[model samples]
Target: MNVHTPALAKAHRFDEPTSVFARDVIHDLSRAPKRLSPKYFYDATGSELFEQITVLPEYYPTRTELSILRNRSRAISSIVPDGAALVEFGAGSTTKVRLLLGECRLGAYVPVDISGEFLNAQAQALRADYPGLAIHPVTADFTAAFELPEAVRDMPKVGFFPGSTLGNFEPGEACKFLKSARTILGKGARMVIGVDLEKDERTLYDAYNDTAGVTARFNLNVLHRINRELGGDFDVGAFIHRAVYNRDRHRIEMHLISKKALTAEVLGQKFSFRPGESIHTENSYKYSIDRFALLARVSGWSLLQSWTDEAGLFSVHALEASD
Candidate 1:
């Protein structure tokens, strides 16, 4: 499959200091031993690639979470009470979202993401599927608290943050994220967040560094993106994907390792990489129930309910603020 790299020459047109800072940070981290933020992993192409990854046999998070949402959607819908606006962070293809919308009654629907193009398209598709559901698509990075679009300002909210995507953030950041969402939502809002439980290292590693080579291409695809957008030179073939469990951190890290010595230029600067040194691309943190509760408490969110797969490999938690 061909992945198109967005020509960000025009990225300068809408340049914000934050975007520039992010761009530069990524450039510096692309060098050996450097690390890329997980947030950068989702340009349009990367986001689409991830949607494909979710369906792979090796990836069970999608199926497990969907089952939970399906089995519990009616019960969860009851918590909405006087009609709730359904807002999904990192909505992606929103495949599982359909099951919830079908089973639970919603007042409206909102999808928030950094990819305007992809977000709008999915929003349109959802609108067609659920004609009764008002669709509000907000194109912003909701990793931090962000203002909801005016269309959704007055609605009581039900946040759907499925797909253990929450694991991408460091524990502290995840807590802060929950707190921010609460402040935005006020007292009445409820959240259903997917949390991947601690699993064997072999299982975790296989998920990120898939044997099919798709994950590898996805990792190095960032370099191809930089080459296209930032005028950088990266030998895509020189890099290999690497993933491992950091037991202490309770997370899996994805990296792009240089297969041989190579140098690349970006934005008029050059970076060198030695064979085997890697650029960290993303982290997926696994949490034990005990550790997770502490995180929820710090974020001012109390765990209301937790659902687990038969093997306990994943969790889908119902969370709300304690009155």
Candidate 2:
């Protein structure tokens, strides 16, 4: 796959930030299934809401993944070559990357995220904490192929994809993402990824359905974004957050259910929803160790090592690009 450069992205009409948001929202809401891309869930408000979700008592993935990272920092850092560039995909917050920065020897840090506002603010904060480290922030959808900064092009690259963000993609897309990442990072590159593990049904449900309603706000923030950016008039309060685990798929599905029959307009187009109708928002797929290992192998990566918490709630893996 070719890298999507900033110039190339601007040349396409659909690539315009507001145009894409308006187009996708109208097209998706018109469809029978009525679904939206989870990528839209990262405007400044959405990003802030998600950070809150991570700390909620019902959420376990963040804490569990952090524990694994803390316990295995030495082994994880060993894979990084000195003077290497760490490129993080969908890097919303600096919380997890801080651990790696403290432990690893690196030349620069590149955070690629869709939310430019949040990304810049975090980059600014990082600069204050790590004065010597070079920080490059790229504002683009990480799901699509995107070029790294020219400054870091010749440096050895290590991909950091934490927060189980890989789970947000469908299985096939996840594999495609690994392949795309391999292409972006180039040969001899290494990746450290975090994956949520299959666990009790209740645990999966609780994580997205937090009692404090932070996750709920995070889910609804997409609609809020549509309103703010695309001149949409959605009754954000008319929808309720719903999360359920699909056993066969081994993923938690988050949806916004309509409280009543309602019509919403976006970009001068109207879409109607029936009572109980849902707009599917996000999916968090839990992976077994063997399954994720196979995913990496087929996507041109070799799983070098994996670490898990004591209860096996989450996993962190070290991967090497394979020829």
Candidate 3:
């Protein structure tokens, strides 16, 4: 793959290449209730499908969060120290960060993501757009341990985690991620995060289950990835996408239900699925403002400020690292 990185922007990789997908997929398929990690849903095709999902009429999170960021960019910029390096965890699309880049006078921008090719392409575009600012794209799973670019080590760092991605993690995992981010950002670091607000069940359900079926394609892209990259033989048509609100868990659960009894092979291993068995794919948890504030407080961050849209469908939060 040809990844164009400008002279001003150099890419970094913290983890070595490995067949983590094959190992995890085989193991998860053998479980009583089969499962797959959502991280796998970011190959080129999956990423494109997700970008489509963000624009669907039923999906309010993306546009709502964008509104909050745009309306509150000034206030959010106030909290960021001058010359601070902005570190974005799971920097998927550059759409949201452009607001910050245009608003804040940051010394550097570091976009960390698991998709190396996509990340590099975005980084190249950012460098051309912002020739004066430094751009360092790191290809690593932000949820795991990874080092920031040495160029920005001594510079103060601010974390930017948007799109209500924290909702993807369970409560405990969310706490762990917040704590890990604190450690990564270091002392006196501030964080700007986006959290989806808990709202009517119908709205939440519709957000994940769109009428255009783009979200369905995004969910099934995982199996397609397995087939392409891992030499798996999965009847992509035999499994249908399913997204339902799990009220008791306060999260949206995405699954792939087997259309009928079938067997799929991957890495020379075979797995059988019952007629109606499902492979749990992803979870997106919504939080009330107070609930998320409490979560941040417990996770080593003091909630500095939280803003929501007029309809209160989504939220943006500013946090300061606690002593």
**After superposing candidate 2, which stretches have Cα over 4 Å from the reference?**
1-15
Q: Rank the candidates by lDDT, best first.
A: 2, 3, 1
**Tens-digit per-residue lDDT, 183-285, candidate 2:** 9999999999999999999888888888888898899989988887766799999999999999999899999999999999765567889999999988989
Q: Write the per-residue lDDT of candidate 3 for residues 82-189, one digit (tens) a residue.
A: 999999999888999998888899999999988888889889988889999999999888887789999999999999999978999989999999999999999999
Q: Show model 1 residue runs off by greater than 4 Å.
A: 1-14, 21-32
Error of 2 at 66 (Å): 0.9
lDDT of 1 by residue, 1-323 (tens): 00111234234452553345336555556544687766656777888888878877788788887787787777766666455788888778878788777777677788888777889988898888888888888877788668876777788888888888778887778888888888877777888888899988888877886777777777777787777655667888888888888998888888888889888765544677888888887888898988888898888888888878788888888888766
In terms of TM-score, the best-performing candidate is: 2
Give, for candidate 1, the lowest lDDT window spanning 10 residues. 1-10
> Order of candidates by TM-score, top first?
2, 3, 1
Candidate 1 local distance difference test against the native? 0.77
lDDT value, candidate 3, whole model: 0.88
Sliding window of 10 residues with minimal summed lDDT for model 3:
1-10
The residue pairs in collision within model 3 are none
